[model samples]
Target chain A: MKQLVRVALLDSDSDVRFGRKMIISSNPKFEIVFESDGLSEDLVAVADGLIDVLVINQRLASGAGVSFYQSLRSLVGIKQATACVLTSAFDQPTLLLAALEEGVSQVVSLEQGPEALMNAIAAAKTGDQALSLGELYSLVLAETPSRELNQDLLRLVGDLPQKLESNLRRLQSVWKKGDAAELENFELKSLTGLVDKLPVKTASELVIRLQRSGLLDGE
Target chain B: MIRWIQRKNWIPEILLATFVFVVFGALDFATQGLLALLCSLVMSASLLFIRRFSFLTSALVLIFSTMQVSFSLLPVFALIGLLLVAFATGSFSQKPWREVNYVASVFGGLAFAADLAFNPTLDLAIFGGTIELTEAGRALTFVIFGLLAISMITLMWIFGQLLISRLLTVGSDIDRLAYEKQQLALSIQLAEQSKRFEIAGEINESVVQRISSVITNAEGGLYAAKASPEAAVRALEKTLSSAKYAHADLRRLFDMINLGEMVSSAPPSLEDLDSLTIAMRETGLDVSVSYFGARFALDQSAELAIYRIIFEALLNAKRHNPKGTKATIEISWLENGFQVLVKDNGVEVERKSALGANGMPLPYDVEDDIDSLLEKVTGPGITAMRERAESFGGSLEVQRAVGVGFTVSATFPVEAIRAAQDTSA
Candidate 1:
C-alpha cells in the first residue's frame, strides 16, 4: 500500500474543477482533499498546508495565480506543500518563465491531457522536473520577440543565423535517429508548437493538399 | 519635415545676397571708397545666415546701417539687404529678437531718411530724384521721406509675418488631413484586431477550455471504468455534453466569419452614458455617472467595451438590490488610464437568503449571516463580466462588505484603449 498524494485543486471554472476532480479522484495513488472554483479566504479556512500538492490555474479571478501564491507564502503555513501551475496558453514565455522563476514546481499546458497534469503533480512530490526544462526553454525561445531574442542570443552565442542553422541541423539529426523508445520524448511532441499556432495560408494549403492526397488526415 | 526646421536651404537667399553684393556693391565701390564697398559686402553677407541665425543677422543689419548713416555712405546694397533681413526677422527670429526686429527696421528707416536728408548722393532712386536743398529744405525733406520710409519698412516686416503664418496654416491643415487619414486606417486595423482578440479569447475561454474539460472527463472515465462501469458511463456522458458545447461555440465563431456578420454599426459608447442612466433610472435603479478628469473621445470599440462593462456592473447592482436601489458609477480618466468604479447598496441580506446554495428557488426559511450573504452574490454574471474586462487587458474587482455594500472597480490602461492615441485631457 503506497502512500497517496493528497491534492487540493483551484480553478475559476466550476466545470473544469469538476472534471479535474474526477480525473484526480479516479487515480488510486492521488487523493483530492479539497477543491474550489477560485482563490478565496475559504482556501485557508478549509485546507491550509494539509495537502501534498496544490494545483492552481495560472489565471485566477484577481490576477496571475503566481502573485496570489507569492502573497500566500506569508500566511505562516504551507511549508510542506508544493505548487503546480496549469497554464491555459503557452504564448507568453515571460509569464511561464516567471512562474518557473518564482519557485513554481511545474508548468503543465492545458492542451496536454489529464495524464500530463497527473505526471506533473506526481513529479512535483518526488522533487523531479522530468517534464523537460529543455522543452520549456525551446518554447520560450520560439515565442520570444525577435529583437529581444536576437539580443539575448548575441549575449550568449555569437552568430544568430549560424546558430539557427546549427539548431535546425541538430534537430534534423535527432529526428533521423528515430529510436523506438524516444516516441515519448517531450521535444518531438512539442516540435513547432508555435508553427502549429501561426495561421499561415501556405501551410494551411499544404496541409489541405496532403489530406486530399491521403498523406494526412483531418483532426 | 516642417519648413522651419529645414531653414538650412538658404540657397535662394544666398544667391540674392551674392547678387546684391556683386551689382550694387560695385556701384558702392565705384562711388565711395574701399571702406564703403567692404561695409556693403558685410551687410550683404548677413543674408547668408539670416534663416539660420536670425538674431545675429538682424543685429548686423541694424549695426551696419547705423554705421553707414554716421559715415554718410549709404550704399545701394545696404538698402536692398535691409528689406530681406526685415522679412527674415519677422519669419525666422524668435523671442526678443522678433520684437527687436521692429525697432531695428525702424531705426534703419530713420537712418535712411537721415542719409537722404544729409547726404543727397544716397537718396533712393525708387522714391524721388536728388534735389539741391538749403538747411531748412533738408529738414522738410527728412520729415516727408521719414513717413514713407517708416511705412515701407513696417509694411515689409508685417507682410513677412503674415506670409509665414499663412504658410503655417496651410501646413497645419495638410498635417491635420494626413492625421485623420492615419486615424481612420488605425481605427479599421484596431477594429479588425479587436475582433480577432475577442475570437481568440472566446475560443480560449470557452471552446478550448471545454475541450480540455472533456478530455479530462473522458480520461477520468477511462480510469474509473475499471471498477464501476455505471459511474464511468456517467463521466463519459459529460464528455459528450462538453464536446457539444465546444463544437457549438466553435461553429458560432465560424458562422460569425462566414456570414460576414463581423461588420456592424458602431455600438453604444461613453457618449451614450446619459441615455443609459436614464434607462436604468426608469427601471428603478438610480444610476449616477460622474466623470472626474477631462473627458476625451475613446476608440469606438474600446468605448463600447468600457460602456458594456460599466453597464454590466450597474445591471448587477440593479439585479442584486431592491427597487430604487441607488448606485453611483464613477469614471476617472487619470494619467495612468481610464477607471470605472460602481458602488451600490446591494440587496439587504440580513434577512433570509433569496436563493439556495445551488442558486435554485429553494432556500432555508431562516435568517442569513453576513458571510452567507457575501457568498450568495458570487454569480456567473460577475465571472462573465470579468472575462469581458480581461479580453481588453483590463481588470474587474468586486468588493462586498457588510456595511460598505458592493463595489465593482474596473480599470483599462491608456495603452490598451488608445493604441498610442494622443490625448490633450
Candidate 2:
C-alpha cells in the first residue's frame, strides 16, 4: 500500500478546521493527523517530526503562518516539507507573496471550494505548485521593470521607491563583496523602508538575491 | 488671486491687462484708448490703497477707470460710492479670499459695462467741444456696445463657472485626504493589533506552555501512588504558584495591549466610566468622574478624541505628581458638547525642557516630539485626538488650569454629529 500523505492544518477558525478535516477524510490518499486553531502546538509538532504537507490560513495572529514555515525549514531533518496557506480574503497580495517567499507549496483560497482545495493538496503531494488567477496576475505584474518607472510613476503603480531600490542594489553589491556588517546595516534600514512600500514579491526578490550571494543562509 | 496680488507679484496685473485686451480688442480705437487709460489709472490707485490687495477693488478700479471716459465727472463721483461699497465689503470680509473675489467681480463688471456704454465714435462729427455721432453711427455705437456687453457677460459667466469648478475640485481633494487619513488610521490599528497578537503568541508559548507543562507533571506526580504525601504536596504548591505567576503575567500583558488598543478604539461611554477609572486607579491615581448627557452615539472619531483628551490630561497629572496621593478627574457631556477636567494636589513640578526617550532635551520646543520613534508611539496621541474631534467638525482645546492640573475639552457642532449619523446609517 502506498504511504498516506501526512497533512497538518493551521487556522484560527473552527469552521475551517471542521470543513478541512471533513474534506480531507473524503479523500483516500490524504490523512490529516494534526489540526490546530493555534499555530504553536501543531506547527511545532510538525517541525519536530515528519509531516508531508502544511496548510495555513491568511489571517494568522501575526507572522504566525510565515514564522511556522521558517521554523519548519530550519528543523534538522524535515527540510523538504510541502506547505499550503488557505485564505478566506484574497485581497492581500502581500500575504500570498510572503507564502511564496517562505517556500510554500501552494496558496489556495477557502472560497475556492472543496474540489479546488483537494486538487491543490494532491498537486503539492506530487511536488507541483499552483496559484489562483489573481495570485498569478499579481506575480506577473510583480516582475514589471523597475528601471522603466520614475518616482511619480512608482507612486501611481507599485509605490516601490528608488532609494529603497538603490538600497536593494547596494545590498546586492555588499553581499557580493562579502561585507556582512555593511550588508546587515544597509539591509536593515533599506529593507524596512522598502518592505513597507514595495510589494512583498519585489522585497522577496532582494531576499533571494541575498541568499544566492550566500549572505542569507536559507533554502 | 488677491493673495497673489498681496504678495506684490506683477504677473497677475499683466495677465489682467491681457484679459481686458482680449475682451475689448474690437472696440473703436479711441474708446479702447480711453478704457485702457481708465483701467491702468484705477489699477494703480487701488494698488496704493483699498486696505489690502482685493480682486473686488481691482475689478472696481477697472470699472471706475472705464467709467472715467463716459461719466467724466460721474466717474469721480462713483469713486466715493465705489469706496463705500469696498469699505462695506471689507467689513463683511472675515474670509479675505472670498471678499477679494467679490470685490474683483464687482469692479470687473462695472468696468465691462462702462466700456460697453461709452465707446467713443470719433468718425461721426464734432459739435463745439462735444463730438456728435450720426444717427447711423450713434445706433451703430449702441450696437457695438450691446455686442461688447453681451461678450463681457459671457466672459463673466465663464469666469464664474471656472472658479466654481476649481473650488469644487479643491473641496473634493480635501474630502479625499480626510478619507485617506481615516483609512490610514485603520491600517495602523490593524497593524498594531497584529503586532500585539505576535507578542501574545510568544508569551503563550514561553510562559503559558511552560506553566501548563509543570502543572500537568505535578498532577501526574500527585496521582502517582508511590510518591510520598509531603513530596506530592510540595509539587502541587509549586505548580499552583507558577500558575498564579503565569496568570498575572498574562493579565499584565493584556493590560498593556489593551491600553494601546484603546487608544484607537472608541471608549464605551461616560456611563461605562468605571473601567477607565479602575484602570487608572491601578496606575496609582484616584480618579473622580462625573457626567450629564442624554446618551447618544457620537462620531466614533469624536468620542475617541474626547477619550484621548482625558487620557492625556490624566497622564499629565501623573507625570507632574510622582508623589501625589490622589487626583480628581471630572467629565461632563453638555449641550455645547463634552468637557474633561483633571486636577491633582501635588508638588508643583519645575517644568523641564521636553526630553525624548533617550533623555536628550529637544533642541526646540515642539507641541509633539522630536524623536521619530517616541513621536510614532505617543505624539499622535494628542494630535490624532485633536484631528479626530476636528474631523467631526469639532474643536478641541488644552490648557494649564488655574491652581493645578491641565484641562482638555472638545466641542462638536450639534449638526455635525447628526449629519454623520444620518449619512453613515
Candidate 3:
C-alpha cells in the first residue's frame, strides 16, 4: 500500500474549496489535511509539517498568488511542498509568468474541470511538468525567437495564412466588443500556443512578426 | 539727534547768529567809545531773536545804525547792519529776495552818502599812513562800494534758492521709488497666491477623487468578504491597487508643491487609457474605451489636461450614477485637433446646495438643473477641468437631457497642442 499524499488548500472562495475537497477525496491516493480562506498569522500554525502539496487560489484576499507562494517557500515546514496555483478564467498572462517564476509546480484553471485538476495534481506529486500541452505551447510562443527562418521549415506547416487569419479575426472581434470578461474566455494564449507548435523556423518567424506588429500582446 | 536738529531748524541758525553778534560787539567796543559800544551791544543782542522775530530785529538794527551815523567808521558798521536786515527779511518772508535786494540797495546807498557827507574829511587812514580825499572822490567811492555790496547779496540769495530746489527734487524721487517698490511687492504676493490656488484645485480634482474611490472600494471589499470570499478577495485587491495609485498621486502633488513645479513630470498619455479603463472596471463600473484615427503624440501639458478631463468625467459618472450604470469614453483624433467624449447611462439628480468639503458655500447656486447639480457635486473639480482645457486654447462642454445620460466632451486645437509640445521639448 502506497502512502496517501497529504494536500492543503487555500482559497478565499468556499465553493472552490469544497469542490477541490470533493475531487481530492474521490481519489483515495490523496487526502486534504489542512484548508484556509486566506493567509494569516494563524495559517503558519496550522500549516506546520502537515502538507505534502499546497494548492492556492491565484487571487488571495491579502496578497497575490505568486507572493503568497514566495512567503510559503520561506516557511520551514512547507518549503519542500509541491506548490500549485488555481486560476480563474480571466487570469492575466503577466500573473501566470509570475507564478512560473515563483517555482509554482502547476497551474490549474477552474474552468478546466475536475479531471484536469486531478491530472495536474498527480503530475505535480510525481515531479513531472504539470502544465497542459496548450500551456507549454504558450510559454514557447512567449519566448523571443533567436534565429531567422528558412522556406524549407515554413513548408512543414501547411495552410499557415488561413489559420493566422481565423485567429486574427477572432481577436479583433473580442477587442471591438471591449468585453473584458468575454476576452478571458477567448483563450488567446492557446491560439498563440498553437502557432508556436508549427515547424520551428515558421513558428519563430510568425511570432516575431506578431510581436513586431503589436498583435501578440493585443496593444 | 540729527532728526531733532532737522525738526527744530531755527536752533542752529540762532546759535550761528549769536556767535557773529559777540564777535562784532567786541570789535566795536575796542575801536569806538561807550556810545558806539552801547549801539553795537544793542544791535548784536537783537540778533538772538533774528529767526523768531526777523522783522523786529531788522527794524532795531536799522535804528541802531542810523543813530551812529556821526561816527567816522560807523558807516561800515551800518553796512553790516544793512546785511543783517537783508538776512532777517529773507528768512522771515516767502518772496523776500526782491524786498531784501531793494532794502540792501537803499540802505547801503544812504549809509555811504551819509558817511561821505558827515565824515568825508574826518577819515585819514590809508595803507600805511593817513591820506585825505576830496568830496567828489569820496562820493564816487561810496557809490561803487554800495553797488558791490548789493551784487554780493543778490548772489547769495540765488545760491540759497538753488539748494532748496535740489532738495525738493530729491525728496520727490525718493517718494516715487518707494511707491514703485511697494507696487512690485504687492504684485509678487498676488502671483504667489494665484499659484497656491491653482495647486489646491489640482489636488482637489485628482488626489481627493482617487482617495475617495479607494475608500469606496475598501468598504465594498469588507462587505463582499462576509458573503463570498472570492468576491471579497478581488475587491480587496482592487482596494489595495487603488490605495497605492492614490498614494502615488498625493506624492506627486506634494513634490509639485514643494519644488514649485506645478506641471506633471510624467503626465499620462493616450497609451495609459487602457490601464485607467481596467482600474475603473475593477471598481464595479462598466467602462468601455474606443479610439478613432491614427495615434499621434501631444504636448505634455495638453496630454495631462486631456487625461484629467477624462478622469474627472469618469469620476463624476461613477460617483453620481446609480449602481450598475455603464460609462463609455470615445477619443477621436481629428485633422486639426482632438476630441474626447465621455458619456454615462445614469440618471441625473437635483441638488439643493453647492457646498465644498468643509461645508462652505461654493460659487454656484442650488437648482434642479443638471448644470447646477454638476457644479454642486463636482465643486472645484469641474471648474479646474474647464480651466485646464481653456488654458491650452481648448473647449469643454457638458450636456444633460431628460432621458439621455450626462455627457462631457472636450476639444483641443492641434496648433496650441503643438506649440506646448515645442516649448516643453
Candidate 4:
C-alpha cells in the first residue's frame, strides 16, 4: 500500500476551498489534513507540523502567493514541505518568476481541473519540480530575449535622470505660476520616445502606472 | 488693388484737386472773370502736388494770387490756398492740431492786414457796414476779425484730431481681436490632439497590457497542464485564477474606455498610501512606508497629484528592482510645505551606454543629450509625474547614481494645500 500524501489547502474563496476539498477527497492516495479559506496566524503556525504539501492560491487577500511561500519557508516544519503555487490568467511573467525564485516547487493553474491538482500533489510528495508545459514554453520563449533586451534598455536609459531634471525644474516653475495653459502646451514626446525603447514588460508597467495616475491619457 | 489704393497718396490728392478746379473755375466763368478762372485753374492744379511740397505750394499760391487778382476776388484765392494748406497740414503734420492752428492763425492775420493796407472800405460783411472809421477804430476792427478767424480755425482743428484718433483706435482694436481669435483656434486644435494621445496611451498601458498578460499566463498554464498529468491540477488552477482576473480587468477597461466611467470614485490622498504600499507588497516587493511631521489635508487635485507621483515611483522601483529589493517611501511635512521621498535598494543598472560591450550598436547614439535620451526610454511616466507636480505648483526630482539605489522625491508648497482646505471649508 502507498503512503497517503498529507495535503493542506489555502485559498481566500470559501467555494474554491470547498470544491478543491471535494476533488482531493476522491483520491485515496491524498489525505486532506488541513484546509482554510485564508492564511491566518493559526494556519501558518500549524501548517508545517501536519501537512506534507501546501496548495495555496497565488493571490491571497492577505498577500501574494510568492511572498506567502517565502514566509512559509522560514516556518519550522514547512521548510521541507513542498510549496505549490496556484495562479490565474491575471498573473504576469514577472510574477511567475518571482514565485519560482521563492522556491515554489509546483505552479498549478485551476483551469486544469482535478487531475492536474492530484498530479501536482503526487509530484510534490516525491520532491520533484512540476511545471505546466505552457509555463515551460513561455519561460523558454520569454527568458533569453527579455534578458538581452532588458540589458540593452538599462544601458540606453542610463542618463535619463540627468536629461529630464532641467525640464522637470522648468515645469515646477511654470506650475508655481499656476499657468495651466503653458502646462498643457508643454511637450512630452521626447520622454515618450525614450520610454518606448525599453523592453515591453518594463515599459508596460511604467505606462500602466502613468495611466492610473492620469498622466498618460488626459483625464 | 485695395493695398495700392491705401499706399498711393497722389491718387486721392489728384482727385480732390480736380473737384476743386471744376467747381471754382465754373463759378469764375459764369461771373465773366477770365483772369479769375485762369487763376482758379492754376491754383487747383498746384494743389495736386501740395502733399509733395506743402509749404512751398501754399506760399507760392498765396503770393501769386495776391498780386494777380483784384482785392475783392483775393478772398476767393485765399480761400482756395487756405483749403490746400489745411489739407497738406492734416496729411503731413506729426502734430496736426498744433501745425494747423499756427498756420491758420498766421493766414487769418495776414488776410486782415492785407485788407486793411490795400482796401480801406473793405465792405466788412461781419460788422454789417462800410464805416469810414477813425484810424483807432480801424485797428480795433482788424483785431476783432483776426480773433474770430483764429477761434473758428481752432475749433475745426480740434474736431479733426478727435476723428483721426478715434478711427486709428478702432482699426487697432479690430486687429487685436482677430489675432486673439486665431490663437484660440490653435490652442483648441492642440488640446484635441493631446486628448487623443492621452486616450491611446491609456489603452496601451492598461487594456492592452493586461490582455497580453492574460494571454501569456493562459498559454503557460495550458502547456503545463498538457505536459504531465501530475502538473495538470496546478496548471489548471492558475489558468482559472488568471482567467477570472482577466475577465475582471477587461470589464474595468471596458468601463473606462467605452462608458467613460471613472475608475476611482474619489481621487486618492495621503491616507490611501497604506493600501498602495500593500498592493506593491502583494506583487512580491518589499515596500515600507514612514511618515514624519504633522499630517495635514490637501485639496483633491493636489492630493491626487501627490498620490500619483509616489505611486509611480514605487511601481517603477518594484518593476525594475530585483525580487525582495527593499523600497522605502517617506513623507515629511515641513512648516511651510510637504515632501515625499521614495527610495529603493536595487541593482544600480548603468544608464548611459548606447553600445553594448561587444561593440553592438544601439538604436540611439551615445552622444545624445540625457534629456532626449531619458525622454525616449522612460516614456511619459516621469514626464507625467513632473507635469502633475507642476500642475499643482510642485516639484519632482529623480536620481539614479552609479552604485546607489534609485530615488524619486517630490515637494509641494503647503500654501496650495491649505488654500484647498480653506475653499472646502
Candidate 5:
C-alpha cells in the first residue's frame, strides 16, 4: 500500500468544491482527511492532529487567503504543516509578492487541471516551494527594486544614511551570491545562534529578497 | 440665473430710499412748503444710487446741499436734510464717501450754528424757541449749537453702519452653512458609486471562475480518454453537469444585478408605490395595498429600499404562478419601526401536490432542521430583496407552507426612517 498524503480543501462555492473533490479523491495516493466550505473558528477543534497539505482559494467569501492562512498558522499544532497551496482565479502581482514574503509554498491558478495541482501538492509534501514559469519571470524580471522594498530598507536603517549605504552594498553582494539558504542550513548555526537581531517585519522582507535573488521557484 | 440673483443684492438700498421719501419728503412738504419738499426729494434720489456709485452720490449730495445753505433758498426746518445722506454714506458707500460725509457734516454744522446765532427766527424754527443775546451771548450760542449738530450727525452715521454690518454677518453665516451641506452630500454620493464598482469587480471574477470550471473538467476528460474508458465517461458526465450548473449560476447573477425597472439613477420613494401596484395589476397578478396607522416619513435611501423589496415581491409572485395570483401588501407604521408584509396565493395548489410527491416539509419553527433545507425554495430575487433590507439595519423573513403559497416580510426601525429629518433639524 502507498503512503497516502492527507489533504483538505477550502472554497466557498458548493459546485467548485464538489468538482475539486471528485478529481482529487480519484487519486489513490491522496487521502481526503477534512473538507468544509467554511471553518469559522471551529476548524482548530475539528481538525485535531494535523494536515499534510492545505489547498485554499485566494478570493474566499471569508476574506483574503494570505491573511486567512496567517491566522490558521498561528493556531496550535496546525503551524507544522508541510505545504500550503494558494489557488487563485487570476494573477495579482501584489498578492504574489506578499505570498513570497509570507512563506507560502505555492500559488496555482484555478484554471489548471488535476495533474498540475496534484504535482504541486505532491512536491510540497516533500518540503519544497513550487511556482509556475510565468510567476518565476514576474519576480526575477525586476526593472528596479519595488517601491515597497525601498521603504522597508529605509525603515530598517535609521537616519544618518551614509552607514546604511555601505551596509546595503555588502548586502546586495550576499543576495547575488545566493548563500541565504545555506546560512539557515549551516552546520555551526552561524546566524540562528546570534541573539536579538532584526525585527520580525524586516526579517520577512529579507526572506523575500533572498528568494527573489536566488530564483527559488523549485519548478 | 446666477446673475439675476446677484442683481437683486441691492434690495436694502431700495428699501432705505422708500423710507426717506415716506418720512422726510412727506413731513417737509406738509410743514415747510415746495422748497423743503424739493430738497428732501433730491436726498431720497441720492440714497437710491448709494449702493452702486456711493462716492459719486456723496459728492453730488454735498455740492447740492452746500448751494442750498449758501443761497439761503428755503426755510430753517429743512436744513437738517444732510443727516440722511450722512447715514447713507456710512452704511452703503465706499471708504472715500464716508470721509467726505464726515468733513462735510462738520463744516455744515459750523455754518448752521453761525446762521442760528445771527438769525433768531431760524433758531426758533429748529429748537422750537429763541433767546435774546448780547455780543458775548452770540459767541456762546454759536459754540453750543455747533457741538449739538455735530454730535447728532455722528450718532446717526454710527447707527446706520452698525445695523447694516450685523445684517451682513448673519447673511454670510447662512450661506456658509448651505455650502457645507452640499459638499457633504456630494462626498456620500461618491462613496456609494465606488462601492458599486467594487461589486462589479466581484461579479466579473465570479462569472469567469464558474465558466472556467466547465472547461477544466472537459479538458481533463480529453486527457483521460487514452487511459480507462470508464474514467473518461465519468469525467465527461461531470463536465456536462458542471456546464448546466454554471449556466444557472450566471442567470442568477444576471437577475441579481438587474432587480427590476430601477435602472434610472433617481431612487424611488414610497410615493411611487401606487404606480408600482398598478403596473403589477396590469400584468394579471391580483395586487392590493393596505396601510395601518398614520403614514410617516423615511429617509430617501430607506424608502427606495422598501420600494424595491415590494417590487421584487410582486415580480416573484407573477413569475411563480400562471394567472390570478392574489397578493397583498400590508404596510404598518409602528411606534419605533415600520413593517411590510407581502403574502401571495400563487402556488397553493402546486404546494399541496408537492407534499404528496416529495413528502411533508418540516415546520417553519424548526429552523435548524435538515428537512427544512431540502424543501425550501428561494430564488435570486428573494436574496436580493433580503440584502436590500439588511443594508439599512432592517430585516427580511420568508415563509412557505404545503397548502399555502409564499410570504415575505421586511421591517425597518424608526432610527433609519428618521435619519434625514434628524440630520436637517
Candidate 6:
C-alpha cells in the first residue's frame, strides 16, 4: 500500500475542518495528525519540527496567516516547515499572490470544491509546488491598502474616465471628495500610490477640491 | 520759537501797516504832518497785540489799524482795541484760516500776485501816485501774476484733497481685506462640518447594509435549522461562520464610525477575506474564484478595497438576477499587477443608462451615457475599486458590455507595495 499522507490543518472554521476531515476520511492515503482553529503559541511550538504537511486557512480565529507565518519564520526558520494556505476567497487574486510570496508550500481554494483540495494535498506530499487562488489573493492583499480602503478608493477612482479622460475625471472626483478627515489622514506615504499616479493637474485639483471642501478647517 | 511763529502772522500784517503809515505820513508831511507821526506810533503798538487775534480777523484788524497809521501811530493802540474785539466776539476754532491751510496758501498766493501786478502809473489816470508804469509792462505783470496765483491755488487745493482721499482709501482697503479673510475662514469651517456629515451618512449606510445582511442570513439559518434537525445542524454551522464575520463587521464599523475614543483597529488582510467569501456563500450566492500569478500580501487597505469591490459586484449580480444565475468572478495578477473580472449571465432584462448603484439614476446631472446608471454601477464601481488600488500606487479599470457583464482590472506597482510594507512593518 502507498504510504498514507500525514496532514496538519489550521483554520478558524469548524465546518471547513469537518468538511476536510470527512473528505480525507473517505481516502485511506491521508491522515490528519493535528487540527487547530488558529496558530496558538503551543501550536507554533509543535509546528516547528513535528508536522510534515501543514494547511492553514487565510484567516485564523486568533490571528492572520501573514503574522502567523512571520512569527513561525522567526521561531522555526523557513527551512523547517512546508506550509499551505487553503482559502475560500479565490476570487481575489491578490490573496493567492500574497500567499505565494510568503513561501507557503501549497495553496488551494474551497471554491473548487473538495476534489481540488484533495488533489492539492496529494501534490504537496510529493513536494510539488502547488498554489491556488489563495496565493493571488495574498499578492494583491500584500500590495494594496486595507481591503476596505482599497474598495472605497477604487470605487471613487473607477467612476472616473480613463487615460487622460480618466485622470481628468479622477481629479474632479477627488477634488469633490476632499474633506478634513481625508487631509488629516492623508499621509505622505501613500502619495506615490494614490495621488502621484494621477495627472498633475488632476492631483492638484483633488488637493484643491479637498482644500476647498473645507475638510481641513480645524487642522 | 516754532509755537510763537505758528501763533503769529507778522509779515503780511506788519507790511500792510507800514505801507499805510508811509502813505499817510507822506500825505501829512505835505499837509499837517503831525498826524502821520501819531498814526505810525499807533500801528507799532497794534503789531505787539497781533497774537491775540485769529489770523483772518487779525488780518482784517491790521488793514483797519494801518489806515490810521498814516494819520498817527498813536499810543492808545488801535491794535489793542482790535485784539479786544476779536477775543470778545469770535470763535478761534471756527476761524477759517486756523483749519484751512489750503485756503491760506491760496489767499497768500492771490495777495502776492495782486501786489506784483499793482502799477501806480497805470492807475495814475484813476488816482495820481508817485510810481509810474508803461501800458505793456502793466499788462504783462497783471497777466503773469494772475496766472501764477491761479496755478498755485489750484495745485495746492487739488494736492490736499488727493492726499486725504488716498489715506481714506488705504484704511477702507485694509478693512475690506480683513472682512474677506473672516468670510473665507467661516466658509472653510462650514465645509468641514458638512463633510463630516457626509462621511457619517456613508458609514451609516454601510453599517445598515452589513447588519441587515447578517441578520437576514442568520434568521434564515435559524428558521431552517428549526425545521429539520440534521438540516438545523448544517444551518447552525453556517450561522456560526456568519456570526464570526458579523462580529468582525461590527468591529470594523465601530473603528471607522468614531462614536467615542476608539482607535482604528487593524482590519483584515486580503487573505482574511477568504473567510468572508465563504461566509457570504453560506447566505446563498454562488461565488467563484480563479487566480494566476506569483503571490504576495498587500496593505490592508488594498485588500479591503478589492474585497468590497468584488463584494459589491457580487451583490449587484445577485440583486439583478435572482433565479439560478451563475456569476463568474476572476482575479488574476498578470503582466500588470492584479485584475478582477466579474461577469454574470442572467435572463434578458433591460437596465437604464442613468441608474445609480442603488438602481436609481445619478442624483446629479451628468451628460455621458457611458456613465449611465448601469454603466456607473458597473464602471464606477471599479473606479472606486481603483481608488484603493491607486492608494497603493496601483491602477484599476472597468470594462462592461451592453447585456453581457463587467470586468474590473486593478494593477499595483510592486515597488510601491514593497515601500508601503517597509514603512508599515
Candidate 3 per-residue lDDT, tens place, A1-219, comes to 999888887766554455456556567788888877766662474346666667777655655666677666666422353445445434355555455545566676644555666776776666444343344335535753334334443453344577766665665566456454665455534455444544311222233344334444455
lDDT of 6 by residue, B1-425 (tens): 32344456665446544664565445544443455445444433343333344454445444443444322222222223332223222222233543343343344344444444452322222234434557677677767866775575455445544544455455565555546534433443344345445555665544443333334334434444444456546545655665566577567656545532111233334554455455435444556677767666555445655665676667666666654555666776554356667776543222334466898744433433354345544355455556557767777666554444545556666555532544322
**Candidate numbers sorted by lDDT from highest down:** 1, 5, 3, 4, 2, 6
**With candidate 5 superimposed using the best TM-score fit, by how many Å does residue B392's alpha carbon deviate from the native?**
12
lDDT of 2 by residue, B333-352 (tens): 56655555655644232222
DockQ, each predicted model: 0.29, 0.03, 0.02, 0.02, 0.15, 0.02
- CAPRI-style grade of the A/B interface in model 3: incorrect
Runs of candidate 3 exceeding 4 Å displacement: A1-219, B1-6, B75-131, B164-425
Lowest lDDT sum, 10 consecutive residues, model 4 chain B, at: B259-268
- Lowest summed-lDDT stretch of 10 residues in model 2 chain A? A144-153
Candidate 3 lDDT score relative to the true structure? 0.59
Span of 10 residues, lowest total lDDT, candidate 6 chain B: B84-93
Residues B120-142 of candidate 4: C-alpha lDDT, one tens digit per residue: 54554644655477777767766
Q: Provide the TM-score of chain B versus the true chain B for each model in turn.
A: 0.42, 0.33, 0.36, 0.36, 0.35, 0.29
Q: Alpha-carbon error at A165 in model 5, in Å?
A: 21
lDDT score, candidate 6, position B384: 54
lDDT of 1 by residue, B62-180 (tens): 77777787676744555766777677667766767776766777777777777878785554543455557899988987898778877887777888789878778665755665565
Candidate 6, residue B142: Cα displacement in angstroms equals 34
Q: What is the TM-score of each predicted model, taking all chains together?
A: 0.38, 0.33, 0.26, 0.30, 0.42, 0.28
Give me the candidate number with maximum TM-score.
5
Scored against the true structure, residue B281 in model 2 reaches a CA lDDT of 64
Scored against the true structure, residue B286 in model 5 reaches a CA lDDT of 80
lDDT of 5 at A160: 23
Model 5 segments more than 4 A misplaced = A1-6, A22-34, A38-51, A59-64, A76-79, A111-115, A131-172, A176-206, A209-219, B1-209, B223-425
For model 1, what is the error of residue B293's alpha carbon versus the real structure, in angstroms, after optimal superposition? 24
